[model samples]
Target: MELDVHKPTILVTGGAGYIGSNAAFLLSQQGYQVVIIDNFKHGQQFYPDWARVIKCDFSDQSILDQIFTHYNVEAVMHFAGLIEVGASVRDPKIFYEENVVKVLKLLNKMQEHGIDKFVFSSSAAVYGTPTKVPIVEEHPCNPINPYGNTKYAVECMLSDFSRAYGLNFVALRYFNAAGADVENGLGERHKPETHVIPLLLEAAQSGETFSIFGNDYQTPDGTCIRDYLHVKDLASAHYKALKFLDGNKSAVFNLGTGIGASVSELVNMVTKQTGLSINVEVKKRRSGDPDRLVADPSRASTLLGWKPEYSSLETIIADAWLFYQKPDAVLYYSDQSYQQSSVF
Candidate 1:
């Protein structure tokens, strides 16, 4: 999948994180030079051999100036932010600060550097308690939590910026990003893991009881339903969105499979994959837990020429089980200094 021999260099924020790292590696594989900037707040230490990994916060104007000046950065892929929904509910101020305020700073710097092309990492949480099963791009955004509100805020900001400042960007609202890039040894790694697939796999290995959150939802299994897409597919969508910006077009798309899986069903899949009995504990539903949230990803497919290849639930569980089984898998956190290039 070689692209232009001298494809434009892309600045990937939070590139050491799960999805961002996968996208950066793929971009470098496809011949697009990559420059990654991360604060390493919760990002992984698994730096790839391809990217010019810089350990700096994307919001730092001085460091961003160095990056934009040193490299011929043609676009920015913003992925750094506080993503924990539960935490966001507890403290909305930090979520707004990290996700919205810091991002605006980065966008301002990019605008100053004359870099108008952008790709945003959005969330499906924006469509709060969807009225329709397969949520579309045009669905009303009534986010029920602070995390979703932050993502929606950024989306609105991008829209206004595009209209006022000639900025071209794509906002990809992702559902549950699961699975692993097993080939690259890159999987989910959160400080306090909140995602379902990894948590279920962890419990399967450690024999810990996995909490089901709630089994009283209105779904088939009496549990909340969500659309899960492989992290690999999510990464590829970012690449496609970057290429879509080459036409100077701005659009919003949903990155998800038009399929929903319940918590009980996912637990069953994990058990099936590992051949281990998963101890499940039902708990009270968290605030604003949507009954069903799938995606009508037709807009992304039609516009970006992208579709999921590794998002099937069976494949997702298999790959994730393999990843968690490895004893020496990469973990997050490293003591790296600012402006350091981690190209190996």
Candidate 2:
């Protein structure tokens, strides 16, 4: 797609991370110029050629000022934050600094630049333990861990910012962000690799025993259940959110498939997809893990005209497997910096 020079450019914070990178590519494909900023702490350095990559932390007001001055950014998709629940539990201070404090800096910059539209890359963790199976937006947010607390704090900030400064924002609370942009060669590449799908795939490939967390939950399989949404679908939702913001609307919606799959069920799907016997080892449940965390995405569908197309468990696993099988697949933390490359 040709660049629409007249359209306002979109700024993607943490555009090198899994979901941010995919969202940046999709936004560029739709002819919207994108400027990606990342501190390279947990984000991938590489991005699409059309995107203007600025290697800087969100907490740095000077660098953010430079980018805002250079580019005509009308909105921002905030995806730059720490996401490990275990790590957050261990070090709540770091999580609060990175997730909450840094975000305040970025929002201050956005306000200074008169950029009111914001799309937040929130997580389902904010909901903590869902009292109901199909969790809705109205559900009480009593996050059980520091990570969830940080996310909820940011959501509260967004609400206050909108009210005080007239900022139009949308917070999409994602369930399980799995899968990859197989066609574009982009997928999850966390250094520790805590997500279930990628961990199972790695175990199948390396013959390692994959831990099953715990089996004492009240679910059907006695394990946790999560709603998995594809990365591309997430990107699509972000795009639609930008369009939805044009009406001067500010809202919060859940990004999910409205379907639930257990941890064991996901392992079985991976086994079926790869034809490799996955070695499973049952372990005690980690702290702050909810028994079930599914989403009621009906409000998103009805309001933003958004629905996930790639919601199938089989499709999500197969796409991730394709990226994992690639011999030259890029690994996270391979180097300190990455060169600008175009996959399209």
Against the unseen true structure, what C-alpha lDDT does each candidate score? 0.87, 0.87
TM-score of candidate 2 relative to the true fold: 0.93
Pairs with steric clashes in candidate 1: none
* TM-score of each candidate structure, all chains considered together: 0.93, 0.93
lDDT of 1 by residue, 1-344 (tens): 11232457899999888889888888888888987888778876555556666777778788888777767788999888999998999999999999999989989999999999999999998998889879999899999999999999999999999999999999999999998888777877788998889899889989999998888888878999899999999999998999999999999999999998999999999999999999999999887787888999999999999989999999999998888776654643333433453322
lDDT score of model 2? 0.87
* Candidate 1: stretches off by over 4 Å: 1-7, 328-344
In the range 1-344, model 2's lDDT, one tens digit per residue, is 22344567998989988999999889989988987778668855564566766677766777777667766788999998899998998899999999999889889988998889999988888888888879999999989889989999999999999999999999999999999988787889888789999999999999999999899998999999889999999999999999999999999999999998999999999999999998999999987677888999999999999999987999999999998887554432323333223211
User: What's the CA error at residue 116 for candidate 2, in Å?
Assistant: 0.5
